[model samples]
Target: MSKISDVILRGVTGAFITNSGVGKIGMPAEHSAGLQQAAASGIPLMAKLPSDKFGTFIGYSEVGIGAALLAPFVPNKIAGAALTAFTGGLLSMYFRNPENTQADGIRPTQEGMPLAKDFFMLAIGLALMTQNEK
Candidate 1:
């Protein structure tokens, strides 16, 4: 990747992850909807854990991913791989909940749109991670 592309990827993804991580860590109350959704989705551990703790764990993970992507010393591929995996998990959760979308299933309802948008991040991370491999 070109220097500009590298910077753009790192900067955009870093900013987004940092913002989300900070919110998740700092504001548990605001994420109640997500907790409820998680429970409804029937994910094993997510439904069992206390919402605050679960949010905190997710926050920490996002923070770690953001830090890795933002750090100059970290390899782009490594950061990209982590981001890809993380967003994939988010996508999985979205898909697991049919109610998140409308009749078509492709179009997202208000509840599911956020997770649906993660595809961009996944794609960007995959591109950056694989770009240098030839």
Candidate 2:
């Protein structure tokens, strides 16, 4: 049996990520193109994919990860691993893009605030992975 707090955490985070993925599934070409470009900054291989394909791929990936987290049968460690990997990629992208950070290099500029906030999600993922099963 899962702890109430853990269940709540998974439910909230999973729903948010799933919703985000759903929104990106049919994103416009221009939007996807821009997102692809940004992603490429961290993972150069992303540049090889077409914007539309990349967008669809990302959307599906998010949905799968979110679903894993939401599914009670899925182990917390497994779901946490997925979330960690996803957030790690986002954090890499945030650090790779110069425009996202300020002169200090760690701090976020106005445009980077959204990505900066992903650190919290990263922390949540880590927490889920480390929590002892009751």
TM-score leader? 2
Question: Candidate 2, residues 21-124: lDDT per residue as tens digits?
Answer: 98889788888998899888888988999887778788998999999989999888888889999999999998998899999889999988999999988998
lDDT of 1: 0.78
lDDT of 1 by residue, 1-134 (tens): 33778879987898899888877775565485476467447455566656656777777888899888888778789989999988877887778788777888767899999888998999988987887742
Residue 85 displacement (Å), model 2: 0.2
Every model's Cα RMSD, please?
2.8, 1.2
Worst ten-residue run, lDDT, model 1?
36-45
Model 1, C-alpha of 31: deviation from truth (Å): 4.2
Would you list the clashing residue pairs of candidate 1? none
The per-model lDDT (C-alpha) reads 0.78, 0.89
TM-score on alpha carbons, each prediction: 0.81, 0.94
